[model samples]
Target: MLLLTLYIIGITAEAMTGALSAGRKQMDTFGVIIIACVTALGGGSVRDVLLGSYPLTWVAHPEYMVITSVAAVVTIAIAPVFRYLRKLFLMLDAVGLVTFAIIATQKTLDLGHGIIIASIMAVVTGVFGGVLRDILCNDVPLVFRKEIYGSIALMVALLYHSLTTLLHVPMDYAVIITLVAGVLVRIAAIGFKLDMPQFKYNSPEH
Candidate 1:
């Protein structure tokens, strides 16, 4: 039950970010709703499809879509407030990332999958929605950038794996640790400007 609630919160936060992205692109109401849904639910849908988990969450639970759509519209109504809450949005996004990662890890493991597949699901759930949002907004995909986005997902997955599988820790404890650590590490990365190495080629300019 708690996991389900966290999942909803994660998607809602993601949807708000998506709504902001759509506003930045000056998209219409329909476009904003579409982008919001894609950003909030796209990652989980992708994960389920890849894993052959039928009956997508939004399909099984239409309320989630409604939530995303409403969030998008509300964001449009108060768009200016977001400009002052950029840091708050980042923090929410970080929490959502951890929530998605933790839920993905738990669900995949519950399905009798191995750690590797769980890790992949973690990354898929953590980053794919933002990737879709960026692509739809005609911006560079954040996961492909020189940031610790994918690393955070992997770290959460690894921590979950180690705690539950190896260390024999309880699910609640593992989740708490992973969620708190993931958010802190993400915030630290943001604050310290920590990033992965980027590739630069001296090719001729077009």
Candidate 2:
């Protein structure tokens, strides 16, 4: 139940960010709502499938659709208040990443997975939504772009696992610490324009 709440919050934040970014594209209300819903639920859906959970969350509880729709509408109407949508999106994205990572880790642990599996699940949950949103919006996915996006997820998952395993911390504390670390890392990466170096391939000799 706690994980569900956290997932909802993460989805809502991502939906709002999606709506703001969608508005910049001059999408109509329907388009905005569609984008928001997809951005919000995409990752969770992927996580469920990967985790072998049947009847996905949104399918099991339709409230997610209704909530995301309302959030999209409200975000679109209040778009003007947020002048720098990119920065706003980044901040919200960070929150979503943290929240989703915590929820995913908890869920994985609940499913009797070990630390390594739990950490990998956390990364999937944290990143797949943004990847879906970018793909649908015809933009490059942030995880594959000039940012420490996936790395942040990796850090959170590793922290969660380490705390729980090495420090013998409670599940809740482990999740909280992992979340804080993920959020801080995301903010610092954005503030400092940090990114992993890209690999370049040279032409093969004939």
Candidate 3:
């Protein structure tokens, strides 16, 4: 139940940030909502499809989509407020990243999958939604280039796995620890300007 609450918060926060991106591009209202929904839900949808996990689905639960769309519209009304809140939104995205990672880890483990699969799903859930949002906005995907981004997802997944599988910690405690630790790691990366050297290559023209 705690995890569920966190999931809702994560999606709402992500939707609002997504709306900011749409506003930057001056997209129409419908485009804002669409990008917001994709930013909020696309990661989980991709994870489910990849893992063949049904039942926990956006298609089945339209309510989540409705909530995200509403959040996006709300953001549009208050876009100016966020203009001075770049750091806040970045932190919110950090929260969303951890929430998505924890949820994906839980779902994969619940499906009787192994830790490795859980780790992959964690990355997919934590990163892909923003990737979709960036694609829609014609921006470079952050997961592919951002500082310590995907690394944080992997760290959260590992922490969750260690707590539940190795240390035998309770789920609630594990979730709380992972969430706090993951977000902090992300914020610290930003504060320190930590970034991977991005991949770069060019082939000779044929």
Query: What tens digits encode model 3's per-residue C-alpha lDDT throughout 47-127?
Result: 998998886567888899999999999998887788788887788788888989988988899999999999989998888
TM-scores for the candidates: 0.93, 0.86, 0.93
User: Which lDDT tens digits does candidate 2 get at residues 90-145?
Assistant: 76678778777767776788889987887788778877877887887888886767
Cα displacement (angstroms), candidate 3, residue 126, comes to 0.8
What is the per-residue lDDT of model 1 for residues 1-206, given as tens digits with 9 covering 90 to 100?
Answer: 66677778888889998988888898999999999999999998999999888898899999999999999999999888888998888888888888889888888898889999999999998888889889989999877772587899999999988998899998888888888999999999988999887888998998
With a 3 Å backbone cut-off (N, CA, C), the pairs that clash in candidate 3 are: none
Write down the lDDT that model 2 would get. Answer: 0.79
C-alpha root-mean-square deviation, each candidate: 2.0, 2.7, 1.6
> Where does candidate 2 have its weakest 10-residue lDDT segment?
142-151
Task: Pick the winner on lDDT between candidates 1 and 2.
Answer: 1
Rate residue 53 of model 1 by lDDT.
Answer: 89
State how far residue 190 of model 2 sits from its true place (Å). Answer: 1.3
